[model samples]
Target: MSRNPSPCLVPVSHANGMDLNAQLVLDQKPIRQQQKLRTLTKYIQSYPSGWKKRFELAKLLYQIGQWQQAIDELSYVVRRQPQVIEARLLLGHLWHLTGKEKNAICLYEQTLAWVQDDATRYHITGLIAQCQRRWQTALDSFESAVLKHPDNSVHWLLLGQIQLRLEKPLAAQRSFDRVLSLKPNDVTALIYSYDALLQLHQVKTAEQRLQQAYKNAPSDFRVLLRLASRRCQQHLVLDDERAATLELIRTVLRLAPQSAEAHHLLACCHVFQGERIAGEAVMQRFVEQYPNHPYGWYFYARLLFQLGQVQKAADTIMHCYQKQECDREIYRACCEILPAAGRLKLLQPMLLEMVAAFPMSWSLWVTVGRVWVEKFNNYELGIAHSTRATELAQDQAAAWFAHGRVLMLAEHYAQAIEALEQGYSLGNAGARLQTIAAGWLEECDRHI
Candidate 1:
């Protein structure tokens, strides 16, 4: 379900463990192979005599996400050749994945009987303990795996992932370091390593890791999104990161041809990039594909309004709002998009309908205050709504700001000063809001 790449395991072609070759013994340490010893085992069930082929097939099936089939194949191999430790080890893992926790632990125990290689046994032992949620035992198992096969980057990374999950930051970082030393271009290890570094506030070091990651896998979405989110010391405004992120998302769009979320991210990027039209081109496809999605209506409307296409924008909102399945978010969105007038004629009718449909939402109350104060100039109606906004929000700053602004317009100078002071204290009033309040406060001061 994670469409994004795991910072560790990016999509490897063939879904077979990356580029496995004869060097697996040297590379991954397949030294526990028992081809001759396997043939000597007593067959308790009907299965092929060659345990290695069975192990390979099981691994292949697991790689393809056929956990059940892999379990079946490995179970067959293990039943006949009880001495095939690798087959039993994988069967334990399959059982764990299949939600058979006790069964998985039993397979690991059985595997331990045949596996003399301390490293393989430790690895299986760790995994079984992991299934049991005995994390400390899992640590002991992976630590043993490292002792036996110190050069196995995969084992090192697995250790790091577990350490990270357990919140052992220093230990996790050390494991990632070993993993990186073995496979210098290992992106996943590097990413997790950066995370550990970031948590320690070793930001400059973490940044260097990010740069290293970008150098290694420039097209990877994990790196790009991290960059977009600007995960580090100084928080950059979302607007500042928009241009590069928008372009990065466009590349993702090229890779994933039909992702509404990707399209939505692009639209958000456009909001900051100041390229409303280019962003809209992407949203148009998402809108067409997922018409029922409220965000589809939400985004396209914002873009159209920003593009000065107010009529079209209004029509889009109306289409979503009138539907039976529409969410309350549509009302909030309407409140958000309404302030972008020159679209008021289009906004007004729709807002009236929304107010009628759901009168109690805080958003609708806010909209009513804004509309009466700004558009209708009906000071009395504005005060009524503004009062409600204040009451609903427990007289919070923005509510008070709205209430004060309406009071100034209605010439209730005494109350306006109190409300404005409350708004100013909360740091909620905008410059325009302050200006109006200031003028009224000064008038009251003079009268006093």
Candidate 2:
């Protein structure tokens, strides 16, 4: 009466655990796997207390990329057998993969409460901190992990990635080098080390590392995307080199159709090829597909700006801002596009929001001051923001320049001169600022 011939054949009950695992590993056919899954379900229905069978089922679901189903089984195992730390860890990882970072962190924290092993504790702590973007905490935890287990390449790799995020490129390079020493030609380490090398100004060495990454993992989407992006940077013109870069980007897109970086690179390739319409279309589709992706919207707006659709660009930026995607690039684009399109009034409310969002952004404060003074003639607000900028970054010439500009706009010539002089005194640190300050000083002198 039944179509499935192996309904009663559960590997769990009849076969040894070793044979069950071996069968799961060796059977590559989907139909056979489905049959096994059905048999396992029936076995579990008969014996609801079979945590081992459930865990194995979860693992099999994970292998087949049925993440949600895997998570359900893992959660069931954890709820029933609270001592199963393995199930909890896998469940946390699945939560992270599903973009439930807070849930993952909560689960990891619970595991930390009962976890006794020093290395594992540190590793879990690092994962929690990494999810929260607490770079220093992650760095400390990963540092302890590497210290406790110097031979662990994964530990070194994590430590290096945190160092890179912290902008310690030299230290990151050393950590990545350790990972390479432990596991040579590791594509992840090689790709990540290329970033460190670039930050260290070791451009030639960076290229070599990237080349090695390509050699090690030609099919890896990250490697392919990185290779294409690097080529795009070096070959900006529409020549043979640029065409080759385009081909590389096409390959990356083929491999990873949903990759944001690949889509952006393809758009850039179109721009380089002088196909502005094609570039615009690509970015438009990208933003449509990934509306929550800030960079995609940012680039789409930028393309709109380049295409002479100033009003449309401003509208795009405003929409992005309203969506609460307060990325620095979006702010920069807003600053550029808004004033050019006479939409500074629209930027005013967003400026206050940006200040609250990024209170420590000295450049943003400078822009805030400039906008208030230039657009609204509100020198009081301008000077307040400019003063805050200078207070936040006392050594930054741009901040001092912004302060001077606001003061001059307020007709406080003497105070403006003093601030400009301070900015000019910073020399090479503010070389361009010095020229602007000198001109403003001459203007102030004439007024005084």
Candidate 3:
């Protein structure tokens, strides 16, 4: 009689095949992943009740961004093994990633009930609170997490961030201090602590924290930028601090040679130091290098204006407008600069083009109307454009106020009062506009 075969050796061939398929998935290359999927499908078909194989397949699918397929596989695995906490947690994470936050929260809450470990419970509570934007709840959960897992610097950091959002700067500073105690070279904690200290008006202490952060990450652009800004705000009478500010800006330029922000800050530093020619040169170079960037063009125009080149400034801003870089600041700058250059006519064509391209822009229509009525004394054109603005943006107080002002200027007292009263009723017409409308209403009553 032969000895009974060992139980482990009975399924050695199947075990080796499964191991090979798992290894192929681990390779993570596209071709290997495809091969692994095919092998896993055949393996599952042969052993239809294999939840472990299905879970492995789900992980690989997730790595490849096949979210729905991953979800289906994980769902099957969870149904087959209801006690598999890891699978349920991963399914919940997928739900959160796909923006099904409520589903994720439900799963996480269920998992919290099953988990006995305080650390796991606290982590799940923190995740739920974060999804709800309940900052105080998140802070309490993170505080508990740090208490249970005192070595976790990340928990402390998150707790500090929540405290900051809740406007308890002192509490936030204390939490950041704990993070720094755990990790002295934590640059994020250093920076955040500095901010909290500044909010609390502990200026000297904030400066020390910032210095420590700089020493830890000398080449960090954000740190350099903040340091330079703080120096500028200090308005130092001492030459050393002023020189240090310039050096910080120079270092930023050196570290990020192609950075437009660095160049912008450098130009500003030069201007602040009263080196107008140097500032102009730097700003001009920035605009040349990054012609499509609106800020570079804006700064360059400002430099031209400062240099008394009003016509050049107007031309630069007009070019910006032609490129469709129109914002409130750009419009305001053009209104000021073009008039000063005695070239208000240069902007009329641009404004007309803008309104034609963007017919729904109420503010552009108002600008065109104001330019006509105030700058050129063209009352008929002004009234027509302002009327068009009111039609397009009936709820906009600016449009109503502008129309009322134009009607008042045309000496149409009754119509002006109607428009002005409509604007005043909107309640969000800014203080200046409201004051002018009120005064104009009095004038209209006198005329009536």
lDDT of each: 0.64, 0.76, 0.72
lDDT of 1: 0.64
* lDDT computed for candidate 2: 0.76
**Which lDDT tens digits does candidate 2 get at residues 1-448?**
3121111111111111111110111224557778888988889899988899999899778655577789899999988887788888889877766557888999999898778878878988999987776767898999998888889998899899888765466678999999999988777799889998876556788889999987766666677777888877776547767767777777766655655566777877787788888988898897777666555667777778877899999988888767654666688789789988998778878788877766656667878887788778898888888888888767656567778888898888999999988876754233344666788999999999
Flag the better candidate by TM-score, 2 or 3.
2
Candidate 1's C-alpha runs over 4 A off are: 1-54, 144-149, 219-228, 231-243, 250-448
Better of 1 and 2 by lDDT: 2
Q: Where does candidate 3 clash, by residue pair?
A: none
TM-score of each: 0.45, 0.67, 0.40
lDDT at 427, model 2: 46
Shift in Å, residue 146, candidate 1: 3.3
Instruction: Please tell me which predicted candidate would have the highest lDDT against the true structure.
Output: 2
Name the lDDT value of residue 129 in candidate 3: 86
Question: 1-448 in candidate 1: lDDT tens per residue?
Answer: 3122222121211221121111000112122223322342333134546666667766755654456766887887788788866677678766765557788888787677777777877888788878877776888889989989999887898899887665455678899999999888777788889887765446678779988988877766556655554521132325565455656666656644444445666665655557677778877877777555555676677667667776677677767665433455676566556555455665566655665554444445666666767676777776787787667554245556657766766667788888878867865344555676677678766754
Candidate closest to the true structure, highest TM-score: 2
